[model samples]
Target: MQTLDLAVLRTLIAVVESGSFAAAARRIGRSESAVSLQLKRLEEQIGEAVFVRNGKQMTLTGAGARLVGYARRLLDLNDEALAVSEKSIDGTVTLGVPHDVAETWLPAVICGFRRSHPSATLKVIEGRSAILQSRLADGQIDLAVVLTATRPANALWSANLPMVWIGRSDFHLKKNEPLQLAAFDPPCFFRAAAIASLEGADIGWSIGHASNTLPDLWSAVSLGLGVAVRTPAAVPPGLTVLDGRRGLPDLPPLHVSLCGPPVEFKKPAVDCLRVILEECLAVSIHAAA
Candidate 1:
C-alpha cells in the first residue's frame, strides 16, 4: 500500500464505471485478463479489496465506490497535465437524456467525458422520452437517451430498468379516495405508464402535480402534493419508494436506449461521447439491478 499508480487508478475507475471488468476492458482498450490483473495489483498496493463478485456481476464495496469519485478526479488532473501534445477532441455535441437518467446517470457521464475529452462539451437537453425522440428526429440534438417500452432496432444499446412509485415517507393512500399523482407534462414515459396502470386497475386518481422537469415533480411529491413514479436508483433524497403492500398499481420496467444508427456517426467527438455515455449508463442499469 505505497502509492496508487496513474495507470492503476484509471483502470480501477474504468472497472467501477463500466460495471464489469470485461466492459471496462472494452472501455480502456485492454483485455479482460489484463484488467483483472491490474485490479489484483491495485488491491495488493492498497491492501484492501475494491470490488466483490456477485454471481456474474461485480459489485463495488463501500471502499470501491468512494474511490471511484477520487479516481475520476485524479485521472482528470492527469489528463489535464498531459493535454499539451494531445489532439483536442473539442466540440459541442448536443445530447438529450431522459429525465430519470439525467437525475442519476447523466452527471457521471458528463464527468467522464470532461476528464477524458476535456474540451468536448456535451450540451444536454433533458425531457420525457417522447419529447426527446421528437427533438432527435428534428435534429435538435445529436443523440437521445430514452426510456422506452420496446427496444428500437436502431438503438446503440439498452438495458432493462425497474421503476417504482415514490413520494414522501409519510404519504398515505385512502382506499375510497382518488390516488393523486405527480408527474411531468404529458408525452412522458413514466407518466403514460403510471396513468395506464391506474386506469387498468380501475383506480380513481387525480393529477396533483404536473411539471416540465423531475425536480419540480419531486418537490411537489416532497410537499405531500401526490405520489409519483420513478426508478428506485433515481428517487430524490428524502423520498421513499412505495412498497407493493401500499396497493398502488405496479408500473412495468422500461428500456434505457441510446438513440442511434451507429454507422451514421463517424466523428471522433461523437464516437468518444457514445462510448463514455454507454459506459456511464451500464453502471447505472446494472447497479440498480
Candidate 2:
C-alpha cells in the first residue's frame, strides 16, 4: 500500500499557508522548481488536483482542504513523537500578545507549541501592544507579538494588517452630528490612528466611550455606543465592519511583528515557539483576509 510522504505533505501545507508556490519554496528552503515538483508528486499520489487558480492567486480545491486538515494532524503527531524521542525540550517560555491578537490566532500558537514541547512550561501575558513591547524589552517575556507603525529591526516575522471601523450591524450615524467613537484608553495605537484619520479628513468626532480592556471596548461598540477602529482579526460576533459607505474614514494599516530576545540569549524552546507563532499567524491572518 502506498502512503503519502511527510515531506510532500509539509510542502503542501507550506504552499497553503504562504499563499503561493514561490513563497512556500522560500519558507521551506527549497528551490521554486523543487516546490512545484513536490506538489505535483502529491497530486499524483492523491489522484486529484490540489490547487486551482483563482485569478492571480492559488486556492485549495475541496479535496485539498480536507487533505490539509489531515496533514496538520499527521504532522503534529509526527513532531510530537520526534520531540519525545529526542532530548526533551524543557524550560519556561513566556509569550506576550496584544489584546487583539490574544483573542484570535494565539490559541493555535499555544496549542501547537504545547504539543511539540510538552515538557516546556508556557506562560502567556496579555496587554496592549505598547505594554507587551515594554515587557519584552525588560525581559519579562521571552517573546512578544506587537503592533507598530513600522517593522522593528529584529522582527522574526511581520505583516501589514489593515485597520477598519467596526460597530453594531444596525448602528447608524446621525446627520450633522459628531461621529461617536469607542476605543481603548489613551496611548493606544488604534485609538491614536482613528483620531488622526478623522482629523486628517476633517471629520467631526467625539469619544463616546473609552476603556482599557478590549472586552469592555467591544461591549460598548456592540451596544451601539459607538464605532471602534481595529484590525479585522478579532471583531466580535455581533459587530460589522464599517467602510467608506458608512461615512467612516479609512484608517492606516499597522505592522504586526513577532519579536524575541537576541540570538545569543534565545533558548531552543523559545525558537520552537517562534516558529509556531510565525506559521500560525501567517496562516490565520491570510485566511481572515
Candidate 3:
C-alpha cells in the first residue's frame, strides 16, 4: 500500500467540512478539479472510498469518519512540528468569542497583541456562548473567550467573571414592579439570568424585544427598548447601571476561560497566544470599570 499523504488528507478534511468539492476548493485556493483529483488519489491510497456523494451534498463514510479524526490530529501535529523548529512567536490562533465581547474589547486586544507579537495571526469567529462552546469541543478553535468556565478538566481552561446588568441612566425602574428586559433568545446565559431574577423577585415584567443578533439587541437597549443583562464590559456608550432595582437572588458570576488540547499547553506558540487572550481580558475589565 502507498503511504498516506498529509496534503491529501488535509484536502479531504476540508471537503468534508466545507460540504462540497467547490467549497473546499475555494477554501484551499485550489481548483475544484484539483480537489477532486486529490480526493481520488487519497481514496486510491486508502483502498476504499472516503466520501459518499449524492449530487452536490457529501457525507463521510465510516472510513472517512475514522480518517477525519486522524486528519485533524495529523494537522495539529504538523503545526506543532513546524512551531518547534521555528521557535518564533509567529503563527495563527483561531479563537471563538462572544459577539458583545468582540464588539467591545477585541480590537484593543488584537492591537496590543500585534504590537507585542506582530507575526502571530488571529482568526476570530463570533457567536453566542453556547455556539463558542461547541466549537471549542470540536477543536475548531484553539482557544475561547467565554462567560463561564468549568473545573480544571483535561481539555479546558476555566476562570470566573463577575458579570452585571447594564442599562441607560434614563432607564427607569418602577419600585415593586417587574423589570423590563431586552434580551436574546434561549440558552443565552445572561438573558436566562435576567429572566430568572425577575421571576424570582415576583416583579411584573415584560419583554421589550428579543433578537438572535447582538447588534439588534444593543440597538434595542440603546433606544430604550428595555434593560439587558450583560457583562460590565459590554454596557454600550450612553448606558448606565440601573442601581436601585434588584431582581432575583444574586446572579452567579460569569466564568471566562480557554480550552483546547492539553498538548497545545506545551507549545510556545500556544502559550504566547494565551498571554494575548489574558491581556484582552484584563483590558476588558479595566475598560468596563
Candidate 4:
C-alpha cells in the first residue's frame, strides 16, 4: 500500500492556506511547478482529487478537508517528537486573554498546550483587553489574546469578529426609555464600542450595570437587568443575541488578535502556544461562520 508523504501534506496545507499554488510556492520557498508536482504526487498516492475550483477561489475537496485535519495532527506529533528528543519544553510561558475569551475558548487551548508540553508551566492572566495589552507591552505576559478595533503591529493572527447585543430572551425594551447597558467599566473595548454604536445612531443609553468581570456582566444581562454588547462566541445559553431587527444599532466588528513580544524575545514554548491558539481559534471562527 502507498503511504502519504509528509512533504506533500505540507504542500497541500500551504496551498489551502495561501489560496493558490503560486502563493503557496512563495510561502514554502519552492517553485510553482514543484508545488504542482507535490500536489500531483499527493493525489496519486491518495487516488483522489484534493482541490476543486469554485468561481475565483480554490477550495478543498471532501477528501482534502479530511486529510488536512489528519495532516495537522501528524505534523504536530512529528514536530513535538523531534523537539522532545532535543529537549523538553519546560520553561514558563505566560498567556493573557480577555475575560470573555477566557470564559469561552481558552480552556481548550490551555488543555491542549499542557497535554503537548507537559513539563512546561503555563501562567494565564485574565483581564480586559486594554489591561492585557498593557501587560503584554510591559513584558508582564509573553502572549496575549486581546480585542482591538485595528490590527496590532505584533499580531500573529487576527480576525474581525462581529459584535452583538446579548440579553435575556424575554427582555423587552420600553419605547422612549434609554437602552439599559450592562458592560465592563471604563477602558473596556466592548463597552466603548457599545456606547459608540448607540451614540452614532442618536440612541439614548444608560449603564444599568458595570463590572470588571465578564461573569458579572453576563449575569446582569441574563437576569434581564440590561443588554450587553459582546461577540456571539461569549453569549451564554440563557442569553440571546439581539440584531438590527430588534431595533438595536449594528455594532462594528472587532479584531481578536493574538500578539506576542518582539521576534528577538520570543521563546520556543511561546511559539508552540501561538500555533495552538491560532489553530484552535481558526476552527472556532469557521465553526461560528
Q: Using Cα atoms with residue i matched to residue i, what is each candidate's TM-score against the true structure?
A: 0.72, 0.75, 0.61, 0.72
Tens digit of per-residue lDDT, candidate 2, span 30-97:
44555677788789998999999887699889999999999999998889676863355788999998
Q: Give the alpha-carbon lDDT of every model.
A: 0.77, 0.81, 0.69, 0.80
Model number with the top lDDT: 2
Q: List residue ranges in candidate 3 displaced over 4 A.
A: 1-87, 149-159, 175-178, 245-250, 263-267, 286-289
Which parts of model 2 are misplaced by more than 4 Å?
1-73, 84-86
lDDT of 3 by residue, 43-103 (tens): 8888878888888778889998998999999877865665554537778878777877676
User: What C-alpha lDDT, on a 0 to 100 scale, does residue 83 get in candidate 3?
Assistant: 52
Q: lDDT tens digits, residues 144-236, model 4?
A: 998999999889899987888888887666678999999887887888998998899888999999887777888888777789988876456
Model 1's alpha-carbon lDDT is 0.77
The model with the greater lDDT, 3 or 4, is 4
Candidate 1: lDDT of 141?
82
- Give the alpha carbon lDDT tens digit for every residue of 101-136 in model 1: 765667667766776777777798887777788887
What lDDT score goes with residue 15 in model 4? 89
Q: Indicate whether candidate 1 or candidate 4 has the larger lDDT.
A: 4
